[model samples]
Target: MVDLFGHAGPAQVLERAARSGRLPHAWMLAGPPGIGKATLGYRFGRWLLAGGAEGGLPAGSAPLHLDPGHPTFRRILAGAHADLRALRPNTGEGGVKRVIRVEDSRDAIRFLAMTPAEGGWRFVLVDGAELMRPEAANALLKTLEEPPPRAVLVLTTAAPDRLLPTIRSRVRRLDLAPLAPADLDPLLMRLLPSLSTTERATLGRIAEGSAGQAVALAEGEGLAMQALVDQVLADLAGRRHWHPVAEAVAAKRDGSGFATFMALLRGALSAAVRQAARGQGAAPWLEGRALAEWSTLWDRLGQLAAETDVLSLDRKQAVLTALLWLTPPRR
Candidate 1:
């Protein structure tokens, strides 16, 4: 079983199931994206396969250890484990497909019908279960209604309410919330050893309680990006013309720092707007009409961000151009 870092609720549920031998046939692990629900599911599957006594195995047990090379682990990692199946969107030659079709769900049903190859529980993990189309969801509901013995189905999603009510009712629902700062700090440090305490703290605040997002930001080229955003905002407040701003953004568009820079620019403008709304007072340099104007600019920048898909590189330059307007006039 993987040692899921934080998610005490699901951890307790797993411990209880192991102790009582009353594990549910299917469980829905629902929470915000990037939380550790998938890790928890993998850990539970490992425990089931090992036939080891559940609940508090010695801290050093091999089963608890994550060995990607182990035969069973390898199969799971390769997504070829006869006893396990995962339902996720297919992103093949035709670009990203948004829905998990009924065919895939039927395959899961077929896989579950057979006895386990290892005489253990068969585990199925559906990532983003809410992506299931109506027919696909109905197919899954049949299995949930009369799940096989010694079979475990784990469905994970950031939005569970989108799933069918029938499917939701048949399975145990475990909610995983964002990790606490104390719990996430060590992980962040490990992931970004070069980050100063101050930088890490800033990232944590921006992460908004999501440890996964914080780690991702730390790994990203955020520092350089943040610098670019700071420069742009300063220029806007200084009333610098847009032409020079556009040139600067265009120059860096292809660099390693571009994505991070764009994200930071968006976040900074958002923070400024929030501050303005709360009457927290703008930066010392921003006062009177300048502050009010920038506040409105910030609102428009946010709208642009929502309307534009950040993944589209073509749209990125335009987004940055819009952000340039947020800068104050130069003396």
Candidate 2:
């Protein structure tokens, strides 16, 4: 299981259901990206597979705690478990696919239908459930309506609203809130011990309570991307040249760096918009701009990112278009 931190309330809720012998057959774990919804799902699976009996922690152990050395934990981690199955977007030659196909969802449903190999429980975890294609979601919805006995299906998603309404209606939804900075601190320390204090602090602020994102930012071009965003915002304020920033983002062949750039850009714009709306903390560039201008730019950036992914549009052009939003014609 992923190294889980915080989310004690959700953990206890799962434990209580197991203890009461009323554990729901279908569960929806909803939260923002990288906030440990999937981690909690995996931990719950580990608890079921390891504890064998539910309801109470052993003696003084924490809620939903299981020994890492336990055979079940090892099996699940190694993908050697017979009764445990998971579905996520499959990777293709280009990269991770954008959506989970219908066939994959069918396979998970079939796995759940089978009798537990260990004569205990069968588990299916659909990580990023919102990525399921329409056909895939419909197939899952059918099974959710009449889930198999002694089988548990867990769906974790950052965007629950993207899921089919029928599918959402069938499962017990549990929303996980973003972790606090305090909660994220220890996680960062453990996962990124090599990071300097300043680097970790920057990640914590930009990550917005996502431990996974913080770790990713620490390991990848996140800091550089962040610096670029800051430079772009400052340049916008001064009406200075932004071609260098756009060119830098466009130079990355794999598009990962560009994606990071967009995420940081969106985050920064979102903060600025909120501040502008509240009539406080508005950045100098935002002082004279109408709120709609900032909000529209933010929305346009998101649309460009999505269009680039689905339509395979030119990323360089996308970056140029986004920068043009801030470089309106001088009166």
Candidate 3:
């Protein structure tokens, strides 16, 4: 019901597994962020609660399409469903916690032990399951090892590799690929009607197939940061002053703006390297550079960015240093 796009194959696989009546007690919906892993998990859970058999519907109805007006859908949306439990990381005094705590993980196990109030099936959806702490992962793994009857647990994660190997082995894994740029157009057009066609296309390129990220970028300073990256690249070979741009980027105290700028910077470098490799005309800044030099700069900047985050380095200084590296050596 969340306007899912793509992944029909995965949906059908779920339906087949359900119809076979040997549905796994736990399912891992793995994919990049914002591509609807959580959405699909919820939909499948809703379908199962609504008597999963496709036989009751008219011809060719999607197995997972529950009517929005239905009580099950309404309850899940309102978080009042008696037979369903959904978990995400909790916020603390500092901010949102990076990991799901062990207490919440144990609570989910308790929720599974109870008989379904609906007298049918109970479901637990763990969004961002990879964020579970080590103890939390171990606690959940116990339930996965010996799941309760008529219960299902769905775990959605961007990085499936981070899950404990024992936990990963217990769940049926479904990996969702990112949507194509063209597929993102409808979402961008609908969510960001004021943006021009060209702007949308650029977002499609920079968003890298995550519609959620595309919308978030449009809502934030992403476009402006991308423009700054373009400006820096266009003037990299010249004597133009760049301190103003670095200062402006550093002044973005929210951190997301600076992060977006760095990401766009890396993307630009990647584009230039790809163009050079393909024997196409590279970006203007790459005019006189060796492919290896450009590649090395890209790798170096990437490491610097990671270190800046880890070590809390001065962002302004980092930007200045990156710009200096972008400059070609004077012959």
Candidate 4:
């Protein structure tokens, strides 16, 4: 169970709406990818369908939970529920990225038009709804305009602005912020119980509230590269020779290593900035005017990252540019 942390404020609002019988026809759930936008959508959907854990957890229990053995849970997971419709990426005859085609999305209309099989609420969930093409999105507009009674639509997106403005206007928006480290730690425990405590802590920091991305980063040797980045920053601060850092990234001419290096470096910089802003102050070199220097360094690194990908520029040189931005060599 992916506990929806840092999201209770919005959830409370939604609960109030549901209890008052004024739940909106459409809801836009927007947040960073991998941070449980879709997870929360399903949770909310289950709540609307009254799919709580069987036998219940006593009064004032969490609504987001559903007993896995429950019929509603099984049907929702199996996509066999009469009152629920789900739209996501699925291949359509040689299509790429398994885009949500208009063909698949047309079912929402038919699903909403009919009465609920359970004589209760009906819902349509579009995960990563931003991935839908123009046609698929247009097809959804009519339902948004005149949804049937007891009908609910949930659209989840990492990038809400990519959606049509008309589509954005009709639904109430629920904004999900990233989970704090404290909040994300326990979730990592549940999801990756096999991981050692150190490993989970490392991933919890890098995952930054994203359970899916944490798994990806863990598998991709992100931690190993982050270690290297830490060494490089330590060398820079100690005024030690840093040529080895350059050589390490240069060894991978494929550019992926450089990208990883930049990502870790950017994370460190952002951390330092945040620490400074909290009145704890950053490292000596990162305090006061030096803070401005780090800011400039971040913006420059961002530009180089953009240009390297866009123009296919030399990655080694781009990394070196970042190192120089950190601390130039002796003249």
Candidate 5:
């Protein structure tokens, strides 16, 4: 395992599965994106291929390094390994197809029919299992109903609710929670040694327990995002017009900075909600009518986060519009 930050629960489940032969034939690893679910799945596959031995597979055995150079590793990475198969969407036109077609699931049948390359266990990993179309999911259900001997199927999903009930019922479900600050702090320090203590704390606080997100914050990306969010909030607090800020943000529609900006808005909104929960005198940065407006904006932000296509909107524009709507009219 790469020890990618967070995923303590998933790591424990895999370890327990290795110790006990009672490991389920299929596992559903569900969690938010950038949370190390795929890394854990790969680690589990490596462990199984290596016969539970540590430090890579034995010589002459199928490569289990998770490195692209290894034969089996390449197969898994390229989605072409004979014994190991990954059920995912086609990489054709239309940008990843957005859904796993029935054909993709059907491919698993061929992989399952073959014997293990190393005469041990065959592994199938479905990254984003929730993307499976109805027909594809039905095809997958057949395999799950009667799994092959010495075979393991792992499904990783950011949205489990999108999956069929039948599929969810058959597999052993592993829920992964966000990583604690203690677990994330060390990783952030290791990844960004140059970060100041204040910066690190800010990132950790905004990460909301996601190590991947924390790293983004520590790397300065998140700060830039926070600045944009702060600008909008500050303008609203001053009773200033928001069109200029909104237009400025909308201009960078597809930039990476926009994504970070969205993350910052989410983090700030979360902080505001926590402050509101604590009642007055919670956050030193908030006071007077600013606190009242922030509390109201918190509810609106929560609703916006739940929107189906929130990600598709211009990052700055979306957040700015929300701020503008929440801002009090100038006298």
Candidate 6:
């Protein structure tokens, strides 16, 4: 289990809810990806299943701190727990499919309908629930609408806005915020032992409070890509070479590459905005109207990113589109 950071408020809120025996059937752990939304959900499940209230805040075994030796921990970790069912994206031989299909949701429904195998609370954790297709969401909605007795369902989503309004209404929202760079430093060091101090700091900045995002960025050559973005941005006056950077980003479109690119792009614009407002940064020259252009540029980048995600727009085209817009033909 990953060490959770900077989310004690949500944990206490959940603890109170669970201890009161009034835990909601559905909880939407809404937050940006790589934050501890899913981790907190699992911890809650562990706490509940371990009969946490029976122990009452014992030092070594707080509800969130179930020792690895505990039966519940072992059961969940081994996927041998009778009452817990977690559905994540299915990566099979065909390819890595992003959407969780309806069939799996039906299986969860069936699982919920059955009596708790051990006569305790049942839990259903849907990681990245936003990945559910329409049919899958509808199927899960049916279960959500009429949940089984002694059952708790948690749907963790990076994009809760994409969830059905009805689904959102049915569940209590527990939003998780990203951790600060200082809070994330220890975890980043553990995860990337070989990373230099400078590289680690860069990852923390790019992570924007998401330990998960930091790990992904560190492993995904984010520094290299960020270097490219910085170079392109610095060349704003010259408009020198975009082909190489564009091609490089285009090549990285498959997995975390696009995300790193977007993070870098957005971070660059955000820095400019910050620099303008605060007179910070070595190049805070974008003082007034020039600084104002950052927001417009940010919006343009965001629109392109949305189109790329929703429409599956060609990666190269998306990269080129962003580049052209960033360095538009000076009118």
Ten contiguous residues minimizing lDDT sum, candidate 4: 51-60
> Model 6's lDDT to the true fold?
0.78
**Candidate 3 backbone overlaps, count:** 0
* Best candidate according to TM-score: 3
Give the better candidate number (4 or 6) by lDDT: 6
lDDT of 3 by residue, 100-210 (tens): 888999999999989999888889999999999889999988789889999999999999999999999999999998878766788788888999999998887887787
Residue-level lDDT of model 2, residues 1-331, one tens digit each, is 2667889899888888877888899999999898898889888888887654453246326667777787888889898999889888876437856788899999999999999998888989999999998899999887888888989999999999999999999999999998898888888888889888888888988999998899888777898889988887777744355667777886778888889999999999898888778877788767556778888888888999989978888887887778777664465
| Candidate 4, residue 71: lDDT | 71
* Candidate 6: residue 199 lDDT (0-100): 87
Instruction: For candidate 2, give the lDDT of residue 107.
Output: 93
Candidate 5 structure quality by residue, lDDT tens digits, 153-234: 9999989999999999999999887667777678778877888777777777777776667775656467656666777666
Report residue 326 deviation for candidate 3 (angstroms).
1.4
Give the alpha carbon lDDT tens digit for every residue of 1-331 in model 1. 2445677657667656755788788889998777677887887776566553353343433324444556777667666667877788665336766888889999988888789998877778888888888899999887888888888888888899999999999989999887777766666777678888888777766675566777776666555456566666565545354445445545544443444555666667567666877898675435534556765766676656545445444444664567545534555
lDDT of each: 0.69, 0.84, 0.84, 0.76, 0.69, 0.78
Candidate 3's TM-score? 0.89
TM-score of predicted structure 4: 0.85
Colliding residue pairs in candidate 4: none
Off by over 4 Å in 4: 1-6, 51-60, 90-99, 237-243, 250-255, 285-289, 328-331
List where candidate 2 sits over 4 angstroms from the true fold.
52-61, 92-96, 239-247, 253-259, 276-280, 301-331
TM-score of each: 0.71, 0.83, 0.89, 0.85, 0.73, 0.81
When sorted by lDDT, best at the front, the candidate numbers are 3, 2, 6, 4, 1, 5
Which regions of candidate 1 deviate over 4 angstroms?
A: 1-3, 52-82, 192-200, 209-220, 230-236, 241-248, 252-299, 306-331
Tens digits of lDDT, candidate 6, 1-331: 4456668788888887876767788899988888788888888888778877455434443336666778888888888999999998776337866778789999988988888887778888999998888888998788888888888899999999999999999999998888777667877788789988998888887667787877777678888888887777776544456667767777854745766787688887887687657856635324323666778878879888877878888876777778776663445
Candidate 1 lDDT trough over 10 residues, lowest sum = 55-64
